[model samples]
Target: QQQVRQSPQSLTVWEGGTTVLTCSYEDSTFNYFPWYQQFPGEGPALLISILSVSDKKEDGRFTTFFNKREKKLSLHIIDSQPGDSATYFCAASAGSNNRIFFGDGTQLVVKP
Candidate 1:
């Protein structure tokens, strides 16, 4: 069974727009949530992350909002650019046992 789930499966946006990706988890012990961005032929890279104690986390153009009580989270990509076209993944960890769970990625397309 999948512990984490992401919606939309895919997304498209024009340059300068913003895209929102949502995720939910089934595990109550999950305390760490990380969002990853991956380009074709490349491995996923950490984009942003949040702890259960934190409600939000942000990087340059990436932001993650977490709701531990609800076991949900969302990733926001601002200023979407052509180069931003890639797959985004939502992941969660319990901070123990070296176990991590990943959601099916959402493919994003940015048109010029």
Candidate 2:
């Protein structure tokens, strides 16, 4: 039941536009939420995160909004730029095992 699902396999946005990626989980035990951003042919790095106890997290142009009651979460990118084009992954962990479950991923492209 440790499955996390993400929507919009790919997204294309113009520079300065806003991009949104959606994710949902099947396991209620998931308590730690993190979003990873990956560039071409590179590993993902942590962007923003929120615990089940919190509802929102923000870092610069990246923001993660979480909903514990709905078991859903989303990442918002503001002032999109070509440099922001990359694959975004939503991940979750139960906080007990420390093992993380990741979504298939959403490929985002910000066109200049």
Candidate 3:
């Protein structure tokens, strides 16, 4: 039960709009939470992360709201821009094997 899943294989939003992506996990043992952002031909990079101890995390235009009790989380992009157009992945790990379970990914396009 170490799988994480995301919804909406793709999304499009106008510039300066807000976009929300959802994620859920099958394992309740998960503790470490991280979100990765990827651009064309580029490797995923850690965007923002939160531990199970915390409920919310924010960085610049990115925010992650996590619900440890429900084993679910979501990412909210505020004032989305063309630059934010990319594949966003939600990931999680149980602090072992150094491996992170990733979502299928949500491709977001911010039109200018």
Off by over 4 Å in 3: none
Q: Model 3, range 1-112, lDDT digits (tens) per residue?
A: 4399997899999999999999999887789889999999999999999999999998999999999778899999999999999999999999967789999999999999
Q: Count the clashes in each prediction.
A: 0, 0, 0
For model 3, how big is the CA root-mean-square deviation? 1.2
- Against the unseen true structure, what C-alpha lDDT does each candidate score? 0.92, 0.93, 0.92
Kindly list the per-residue Cα lDDT of model 1 for residues 42-84, writing each as its tens digit: 9999888899989988888888999877888998889999999
* Stretches of model 2 off by over 4 angstroms after superposition: none
Order the candidate numbers by lDDT, best to worst: 2, 3, 1
**TM-score winner between candidates 2 and 3:** 2
lDDT for 97 in candidate 1 is: 66
Residue-level lDDT tens digits of model 2 in 3-112 = 99999999999999999999999899999999999999898999888999989888999889999889999999999999999999999999899699999999999999
Every model's TM-score = 0.96, 0.96, 0.95
